[model samples]
Target chain A: MSQHSIAIIGVGKIAVDQHLPVIAKNPAFRLAALVSQRGIEQAGVPTFRTPAELYAAMPDLDAVAICTPPSVRHQVALEALNAGMNVLLEKPPAPTVSELADLVRQAAARRCVLFATWHSQYNAGVEEAKKRLAGRKIASLAITWKEDVRRWHPGQEWIWQPGGFGVFDPGINALSILTEIAPEPFFVTAATLTYPANRDTPIAARLTFASDAGLPGAALTAEFDWRQTGDQTWTIEIVVEDGTRLTLIDGGSKLAINGNLTVAEPMAEYEGIYARFAGLLDRGESAVDAAPFHLVADAMVVGKRETTDAFEW
Target chain B: MSQHSIAIIGVGKIAVDQHLPVIAKNPAFRLAALVSQRGIEQAGVPTFRTPAELYAAMPDLDAVAICTPPSVRHQVALEALNAGMNVLLEKPPAPTVSELADLVRQAAARRCVLFATWHSQYNAGVEEAKKRLAGRKIASLAITWKEDVRRWHPGQEWIWQPGGFGVFDPGINALSILTEIAPEPFFVTAATLTYPANRDTPIAARLTFASDAGLPGAALTAEFDWRQTGDQTWTIEIVVEDGTRLTLIDGGSKLAINGNLTVAEPMAEYEGIYARFAGLLDRGESAVDAAPFHLVADAMVVGKRETTDAFEW
Candidate 1:
């Protein structure tokens, strides 16, 4: 308990931009090492090239933060779990839901901690929104998450790679938030995804969900796009039966109801995530949510086919 | 247990064609009553307009099988569980993975059994195939699941509806088999989903998975298409390190390895599933495999999207 010494796999932008600073600020953790193919320094931590090498050398590390692409996180997580270390996995736990299940099973078998951190779920206003909306009958809900890929991702080619999740990479942030805030259980009712013909993933998508049979006349709809021209948007607005509308903007940091300001809080996504992870680790528990990924899968499982014009970056 | 009186919910085509006759043959379960929006009839048992009305009226019903579309199965399952009844839920268990988890959690909370039945996983040859493949390093896998939706599903529009899981409705059957046979978890590396313009879901998709980090050399590639003519294909072929190829036909009824028929078994998909469910119920335990659904979801979350030509009936 002195300090849960942790190493990080896949030292990429997120490792630098969010994870490192969060660890640095939190006294509950100590940055032990960073494992990546190139062994790059995300603000100067010890580096290891592969999971085997990292684990064999660092026997004292208690946990590992997996920041790799979804495709490879499972293998790394499995290794960490097998080596009797806890895991703090990034969103979309593994490249596929199946892999995540295996990881879950493995973690349970090993009695090691596994946390699937949906950063968006930790927004400052999320807990407040969830508490307020619970049991309140929802009339209609809409979420629009669109951003220009070039502006947001810059040179991150992995975003377009096979397991990169393309627009969904960012779109999942919205899904993570929705999964947390929805008062009732909802599933994808219908969806239309648009892919840049040349890319391996969708560039834009329209997703719809309903509360049980899409009956009761309650609905949830989401639009995720990487082609928005101006003003990056990540917002959710819900109209309840009582004739009040709740709007959460900048991905749950600010909120308004009926055009009146309710909560205008600052972003603390990663901070909240780390605090939650620490709690889980402290309690000998595992926190894994596969709902957000399941919705995305439902879209692929049910969505119709379309071929847009090829995109040339 | 006195014919294990069971009620069928959401009596659709699958119930009439598969569930009823199977129940009749089993002799272990008796079709006590059926609950559907539109009551269906055959012989013996009466039908109720809804699950609430049926369960309310029948105190003799010992178990319930909720066979609705994936989108709404969770509610019926939850309802059945709440009524102090063991539940046999069709594939999906619910519209979303999270819902499935909730059902799993709910059944535990109530101490009543909930069965997430994957009809295909019980295929006659699956166990034999799984035994043969276990512990052996899998080199690669190929799943080809193609059928004429118009012929099989006909005017059943709900199959293409979101949460209905489009081609994955069938493809997931393939995954159920793959997940059972494989030794380790695999993640989707790349995918191109082809959807028809008129529909909200994809008609065809190519999904690839790897045991490691999108390793270049060898892996499993699953191909699912709704547009098939003449002889339909549902098969899984595994390539091993010894240069031997193994194939299972009729969803694991027949198996052959390296040009020699290593095993050719009978089809018993439904019975196998029921047998396992019975065993689980006897042990007061749950055997749920979310691997198939997770794989599908992970692919959707990460796979790039594309749209193809419009599908016509």
Candidate 2:
């Protein structure tokens, strides 16, 4: 019932753009502090340079939202969980499944709620689409998530580094939504990952998936690229056996069924994330879904690799 | 207990070399049938071209040992589970964690035992090492598993394909032992994977891991390579906080503690695998240890990728 004091770790672009504003609007969470290497000063909140300093200064903090890149998320999240703080992690959770699994165990051992938040899964229309497609037999599905890395990510060099996930950093958002909406579990049957000649991560990928049990001739495919220059497209289209087609565009912020617009609303992904985090803390549960990340890992595991032209910012 | 009628799926090299012998020696099981695409005939036993035919011919079969490649294991396992037959999968289980997880759920739903056997964990000295390391503070660990791919795998083209796991096929055996022996769970911190210039999978990999709560300065590392030519090496060395050094060599067939030989015995990995599978079936439970495979998947997810010299079979 009381406001949960939450701190934001790694106050980078996402934190400034999405998390801060959402936290400001959500009465359930109060922004308690900011942890960053940069000497960022907030008008009315405390700021610390590291998780250790934040914990030391604000031992009473109820929770912390980690906005760091996936590479360093596990360490920061572990520290918060060990310090008895309910923790919320940004998308893609950790760089590896093992780290996320360890954090889940640690959170349970410490009786803390750890939420591996998939922000895109909280897009305004995601729950609506999930409800609509609950029992429908999916005849076919396609995900087209193409974005220009230059415009979206700019100079974030980490995106090109190993464990940065490159295109998967955005591609995984599509996967998260797909996993949320799919009626049955699916596994990657085949994939081709195209890496820039000079980068450690892929710049584009094509994935084919199949459900364990599906109608004859049913299929699922995803095409993800970081080279789209105009009108960044993020869309998922699903055709049901009953002839109803469902489509979610704009990273799941809009939904259409049978070629008719059904739900198109303003984005509130981060707000939903915080609300869910608060509810998890209240219910004494940990919401750590590794499905989306597992798909990404599976893609990396089974994906055939090819080198493409060198990418430049 | 009556002997369980068990069919061998994917009558490949492993099935012929390991599974058949083990099933023959174990009176608890009877070789019911063989399923393979190859039209090879085994004396005095039934043979079928596919799992469907095998199941169709022998609907009363009690169990099936799936020795298929990891890529196709899930499909076969699901069929067996759905048919109410206890299933045992070879190591590296399914190509992906999601597939294995789905199989686990399917087996649970059907009330059929699903055993994801990590045969190396059943190595002669592995259980001994696990018992000896229990409750001890592990200061550090190093796993060196280098083998000649040509010698071990022969002309196995799948080993170089995506999802074949390349060097990790052997490396996961070491991980299974480590996961069994470690006092606590550990997660990969950093990794370097070297793929051959012409291959989709890594030819060699180096990984670093750390436990969430361990002795100060504790560390673990693994080096796996497929290029070793002569005197193939498979070893794991561990140092306890009290300066006790433990070593397992010859793929866990030999063990030494504090530089003194502690265990040296012939391997019965496959026999042990069958025994565990039978035990699971008897107990109406599933033994799906995803730890080792999770480690491999995590390595792929986080490891830095480097292209090495082209590999020639």
Scored by TM-score, the top model is 2
Model 1 earns a TM-score of 0.87
lDDT string, candidate 2, A1-313, tens digits: 6789999998888899999999999998889999989978789998899899998898999999899877778888888987889988888788888788888888999999989988899887788888877877788889999999999889989888877888999999999998888788979988999999989889999999988335677878999999999899999988888878889989999999988989999988887888888888888889988899999999999999999999888
Candidate 1 local lDDT, B16-81, one digit each (tens): 877877877886777798887876776888889888888789976778878887667777788888
Candidate 2 chain B worst ten-residue window by lDDT: B211-220
User: What is the lDDT of every predicted structure here?
Assistant: 0.79, 0.87
Can you list the residue pairs that collide in candidate 2? none
Displacement of residue A222 (Cα, Å) in model 1 is 2.6
lDDT of 2 at A154: 90
Q: What is candidate 1's lDDT per residue for A1-313, written digit by digit as tens?
A: 4567888888888888999899899999889888889858655567889888888998878898999877668777888998999999998787777777778889999999999999888876777778878878788888999888878888777777766777878888888888888766677656787766677777888887866422376767998888887898988988877878888888889888887878887888889888888888888899998788777776766554455788655
Error of 1 at A309 (Å): 5.9
Q: Residue A264, candidate 1: how far off, in angstroms? A: 3.4
Best by lDDT: 2
* Native-to-model Cα distance after best TM-score fit, residue A122 in candidate 2, in Å: 1.6
Tens-place lDDT per residue, model 2, B1-313, is: 5678899999888899999988999988989899889876789898899888888889999999999877788888888887879988888789898998788888888888888888788876788888877887787888999999999888889889888889998999999988887778878877999999999899999999887435778777899999998899999998877888889999998999887888898888888888877777777888888889899988887788998899887
For all candidates, state DockQ relative to the true structure. Answer: 0.54, 0.78
